[model samples]
Target: MSTLQVRVARKVSEADGISSFELVAADGAQLPAFEAGAHIDVHLRDGLLRQYSLCNPPQERHRYLIAVLRDPSSRGGSTAMHDEIEAGHLITISAPKNHFPLEPAARSLLFAGGIGVTPILAMAEALAGAGADFEMHYSARTPERAAFLQRIAAAPYAACVHVHYDSGDAAQKLDCAAVLGAPRADTHIYVCGPGGYIDHVLGAAKALGWPAAQVHREYFSAAPVDEAGDTAFDVKLASSGQVFTIPPGRTVVEVLAEHGIDIPVSCEQGVCGTCLTRVTGGVPDHRDVYLTDEERAANDQFTPCCSRSKSAVLSLDL
Candidate 1:
């Protein structure tokens, strides 16, 4: 992965307490190339690494734009990104990665919940450029807390976009069925949101007989960390030729980083899929909500954070 030392060049706060940060390379170098629906891992002052989607269009050459919602209960990633990071300060970040890529389809339906709009905004712009049939369903707690509501409302397909405010009225709560009804064979439903929101949309779509392949989702919250409540396991790094024992209370990510193995990681909770590594051996318990059954069956990749090995010793590609 390419590591870039980025300098915060500008900062702005929009409605709904969302803070947008514009970052440029510290040395005034051109930023790494990235596509829509891509995200980068940011290393914060507190040693916490977090992932933020690149919302700005690729046409913006001078800087990369990222929006952060100050999660009050956060472990300080967003809080620090919003409060401490300022213009001229340098920060380390991983190159942009895209696991939630937009697939080719005749038409598309995009769903964004709260801060989840970051990636979907870029997707909408790309769809517009391609002249594809697409609509965006943006839902939030209230109109006041919705970030970029105005900007999104002014997009090319703004008339097709649907905004739902949970506190407004029952009808305002996102009607997944109405928006997703009778999906065309080539229609792809893309969703990114809080765990509950993603689950609701996916579940409802599945119940409506939409094929699993037609639905794509990105999760903002990590899955349950305590798989089986408590179990210690062993992890073997193939390249390093070393073994590490994960204690019951600690996770694979904590142990690996502690050993200075330097596997790229963000959202240490395991939902972001940032610490994903190829599995050389061992059946992963597959606790994460990110991977599909087919992906878990392949056993080629596993997130080191919440997922553990069913076998006594797990071997990793990394």
Candidate 2:
């Protein structure tokens, strides 16, 4: 993958545990243009790669802004960004890639939870710039934990944005049912946040008879799955007729790598669709949060990073 060397021009504490990093080209040249909802992969120490959404306006090319929440359970990515990286430090990152681009609609509704506001903030900026009709509801545990409160308040579309705090009064809280209301064909809903929060928003939409296509979501992390009953499985390569046995508690990617077969992967949790591979035969367990319901039902492609096979023998196109 092509990468860009960038200098950390500045780093500021955005909220309680969130820090925003401003990255500029190392050579002081214009960076690649990115659309809203785009994210860049930050390559960190120990070969750790993490994706962070760009929060700044999409029209700007001078710098890229990304916010990172110091996760206590981080597998070294967020911790390194918070401790090792500093202003004036040089870092390598991939160019922006957007899997959550905003779709056109007559009216848009956006819901953001905690740090999930990163992408939604960019979407608001893009929508505001286009003079499109949109409304945003931001939910946080508390005001102090919310990132970009000042930025959102200062935006030209400030009136269209609503802030909700879990610690605040019950009446002021985010009522998903009330906000979502009846589904309209011309109105689209976008949501991003923790798994439970995303489920709440999506569940409400589903109950309201909202079409799946009109409701979009991006998950920051997937819910933990119970693997106590997981069993061993075999994967067959269609190209070379090679078969590899994936043992219990072992991932397909790890086993494949031992056999000199490499699959590009990021966010090994299956949040990023980097290692998605075509399945020639057999049913996939489908543990990834990246694929939609329809995509998972197709069973033609699967993320080998974390997903496993339901059948005893699964065939891969590669």
Instruction: Check candidate 2 and list the clashing pairs.
Output: none
lDDT of 1 by residue, 1-318 (tens): 668999988887866678888999888889888887898999888678888999887656678989998887788888898788887889999888898899999999999998998999888888887889999999999888888777777766788688899998888888899889975798999999788899899889988899989899888776445444667779988988799998877778889888887776668676777678899988887878778868999988888777788888899987
* Cα-based lDDT at residue 243, candidate 1: 94
* Per-candidate alpha-carbon RMSD to the true structure: 2.5, 0.6
Q: Model 2: runs farther than 4 Å from truth?
A: none
**In model 1, which residue pairs have backbone atoms overlapping below 3 Å?**
none
Q: What is the C-alpha lDDT of each candidate?
A: 0.84, 0.95
lDDT of 1: 0.84
Q: Which candidate's TM-score is highest?
A: 2
Model 2's alpha-carbon lDDT is 0.95
Q: Relative to the unseen true structure, what is the C-alpha lDDT of residue 76 in candidate 2, on a scale of 0 to 100?
A: 93
Q: Number of the top candidate by lDDT?
A: 2
Candidate 2 residue lDDT tens string, 2-102: 99999999999999999999999999999999999999999999899999999999999999999999998888999999999999999999999999999
